[model samples]
Target: MFNIAYRMLGSVAEAEDVVQDAFLRWHGADQSKIATPPAWLTKVVTNLCLTRLSSARARREQYVGPWLPEPVPTADGALGPLETVEQRELVSLGVLVVLERLTPPERAVFVLREAFGHQHREIAEILDIDEAHSRQLHSRARRHVADARKRFPADRARHEEIVRRFLDATLRGDVKGLEQFLADDVVSWADGGGKVTAARRPIVGKAKVLRYMLGFQRRPELKEISAEIAEINGQPAWVLSWNHMTAVFVAEMEGERVAALRAILNPDKLRAVTNWRPV
Candidate 1:
């Protein structure tokens, strides 16, 4: 339950708060009256998450620049036990950006069902809604998310091979090579939240994305930037650093090409990298 809340909220401290609150709510309840403690905990935590999500959406709308999720890196570079390899990749910055298109309730239902494996009945209890309404929301959310995401076969090895090629191309500044691996209409987005410099708009089209990458590589200050491969979301990704500053890049692959690139450079968004050290 703690892991579930932590992943959902992206804050250990906040997850702790939610967990404690849930337990407190159940403290005096009759033990026999609750058939399933886990389900009850999940309900409490998820409802709390929905509340947080609502407030977060309001704050992000007024945010100074592009907004990105708080990155979470484990020792093994994967989301914790609760998440599968596929879910991790599907929840990357690119996917999360698409999720922003859905309404708050839609997002909640999607995450609860698709990401967390909750059934409509479980989700209904969690969100405090009727079963039918939960089913409707889940269906709507799934459709929106499916439309937004590519239909890539779930092949981890293939995904890693593509990512490795991407890293090689990036490190070598092989614009042509990189271009060959990008989709014709590739898009790239950066989120710095105005705390650091980043693209204010999405870089659309393969040609523009190629030019942007080339230009970024040519920056005089970038000569000092160091990069490493790390697990981001659930797939291999690049982590760049200069002095104490850090940035993370995760790619979305389509076939043998890159469909989208997500770069997270905001210092405030790199809190999870605070303890990260260059290799």
Candidate 2:
């Protein structure tokens, strides 16, 4: 339940709060009347998460720049240990961003069904909706996400290989090689939330992305910008650091090339990564 909340809210502290609240509600209720304690607890927690998601969306609308999800490390920073394929996909910044397009309930339904393997009946009960309605919402959510995310059925190994090549190009400042690996329609989005210096608008097209990457390499302020391999959302990603500040950058791959790149530089958004030390 804590893990579920963490994934949904992208904040460990907030997840803990939601879990605690669920437990409190359980404690306040009569045990004899509940047939399934686990389900009841999940219901309470999911509802709390829904409320959090609602407020979070409102806040993000007023956010200074683009907004990205917080990145989480695997138990040992090794992707192999993260067992579930669905869990791995959920961590992808691209998938998370697409999830933001979903309404709160729709997102909750999708996560519960896709990540936890809950049936429609179970989801309906958790969300306090009819089973048929739950099914409809889930279907609608899946379609919308599918339309936005073209990198479905992720290939972890292929993604890792591409990321390694990208890292090599970045380290060597090979602008041409980097551009060759990006999709023509490639888009790079940075979320700094007005707190850090980042691209105020989305860098569109392969050419623009190439320019941005090269500019960063040439910038005096970014001279110290270095990248280290990190497991974000269960996929191999790069953690960008300049001096003491750090940001997580993850790519969404389409076939062998990167379709989109998400650079999360917002300090407020990086809270999840700050507490996650590689084991």
Candidate 3:
């Protein structure tokens, strides 16, 4: 249920609320009539998410800076049992960003078919739509996401090694080391949600990204902050906190090269991640 809600809303807090609301309904429901608990729960959760998406889209439009999905610690299946790479990819920050472009119904269909392996018939029943429409929505969604994607290195060890050096370069303000890890077309995004300071827009290209990272080392307060590496949003990421301000930095890689960076500095988004102990 949390998995469905998280994929729907992209905000952990909102997902939790939706799940809580679903449970509240279940508590009041006539237990004897719920012959299939899982199906009943799924139907309720799906409908609730549909209603929430209507409002969520509005909130996102007003969101400050580049809005990023709330990062969840995934090493322990904290976001649910992501037992396969395909499952992990379904919740990736990049995929979530792409998924945001899809309409709510379309997104729901996509998640159902791709992430959960739901058939058109089951999806139609769950969404109260016919099988034909379900298939249409799924096709539309697949095109939208497929058109915008990347090929990250499948090697987790190499990916982690690159991220480690990237962080080290930032701390040392090592321009050369930073550039080496970053791809030529690297892009960086920061989400402060107007509650904190962050890049108002994406910083693109290797040079600009290098400058932005090196700038971090100039801050004396950063030296007082502790950094930890953990699997966030299904990738090795940095969780840093200083002066009550917390942020998560995760990257996209091509082979051994860092291709993109996402920094979530919004305190609201950081709430779900507060308990994440870095590996």
lDDT of each: 0.73, 0.79, 0.86
- Give one digit per residue, the lDDT tens place, for model 2 in 1-279: 876787577665678899899888888999999998888888889989999998998887888888777677675632233566666776566777788888989989988887778999989888889999999999998898774456743676777878988977876779888988999999999988898899978999998899888877777756677667777777888877776688888888888888888888887767666666431
Judging by lDDT, tell me the better candidate of 1 and 2. Answer: 2
lDDT of the structure predicted as candidate 2: 0.79
Tell me the lDDT of model 3 at 268: 84
* Best of the candidates, lDDT: 3
Residue 128 local lDDT, model 1: 77
Against the true structure, what is each candidate's TM-score?
Answer: 0.85, 0.90, 0.94
Q: Stretches of candidate 3 above 4 Å error? A: 147-149
lDDT digits (tens) for residues 170-222 of candidate 3? 88888888878889999999999898899999999998988889888898888
What would the per-residue lDDT of candidate 1 be over residues 1-279, giving only the tens digit for each residue?
665665566544566678888889889678689898888777777888767777877887887766666666654534554145466645565566667667767777777787778888878877878999988987887777674456333676788788888877876789878988899989898888887888888899998998888888777867787877776656667888886788888888778888888888877667666555642
Error of 3 at 247 (Å): 1.0
Clashing pairs in 1: none
Model 2 error, position 249 (Å): 0.7
Q: Judged by lDDT relative to the true structure, which candidate is superior, 1 or 3?
A: 3
